[model samples]
Target: MFGFGIYDALIIAGFLGLQFFLSARNSAYWGAIIPVLFISWLTWLLVSGEIKSILAYLLILSIGFIVLLLEWSEGRKALRNRREKELAKMRSYDMN
Candidate 1:
């Protein structure tokens, strides 16, 4: 369908990228992505005038939220792993 054209496809990719960048715990890039994303959505709304289509975009945001959760848990796991590694190293050093 025309609704899912090349432009829409690109926007979908960008939405996912934005989610990853945001969930990466990196704030430096948000300044670049936030305005662009907001304006893109605004322009798309004005041009499309299809309220029903917003649900699809919102679904992308939902996916972004899920990504954020995953990233947070991953960060916790990594931190725990690092601590365990440090403890192992300390114990080996004491044995030596």
Candidate 2:
């Protein structure tokens, strides 16, 4: 089904868990839980082999992609900010 196997499910769960961990401070807890649940539900829908099931899976996947993209952008920005702070601290130490 869509080339997804048990490994894919595990990977999806792991990725969602990691995203949740990274963004827990920035997002509502349910926001992360919802995606992880949707991922599982989508997997089941894909395996059901019905037209409506397929559509449902597609919608879930689309939402998941959007969330992941948002998380990625936020992570990049946070990392950049952290690096800038570290650099500024180092410069101040050097000046002294």
Candidate 3:
């Protein structure tokens, strides 16, 4: 199981949920906080030696990064779509 315990799994799951929530909020402050939290958690793990294996640590980091990237891209896509819709509405009004 790559040295992952129940604790590690639960923490990762929680972070994933946090990432999703922050992405959905789409605020500048919240957007900045996720990466900081991610880094702090990893640093704490490394310092506390909770995870012994290097492979396990890397795997955890990779999973977190992938989830964060996916959620961020999705958020951006949604924002773009919303902006495009608003622009279209304004253009229609101008034409009318």
**Which residue ranges in model 3 land beyond 4 Å of their true spot?**
1-30
TM-score of 1: 0.44
Candidate 2 lDDT over 1-96, as tens digits, reads 357899999987787656655654454453465457667767766777542565667776898779775775565566667778999999999999
RMSD values for the candidates in order, in angstroms, are 6.0, 9.2, 3.7
Off by over 4 Å in 2: 1-17, 20-41, 48-52
TM per candidate comes to 0.44, 0.54, 0.70
lDDT at position 76, candidate 2 = 53
- Candidate 1 vs candidate 2: the TM-score winner is 2
* Residue-level lDDT tens digits of model 1 in 1-96: 135789978986676555545534434343345445555765586458744466656665566556545554554455567678999999999999
Kindly state the number of residue pairs that clash in model 3.
0
* lDDT on C-alpha atoms for all candidate structures: 0.58, 0.67, 0.73
Worst 10 residues of 3 by lDDT: 23-32
Residue 8 Cα positional deviation in candidate 3, in Å, after optimal superposition: 9.4
Judged by whole-model lDDT over C-alpha atoms, candidate 3 comes out at: 0.73
TM-score of 2: 0.54
**C-alpha lDDT (0 to 100) for residue 56 of candidate 1:** 59
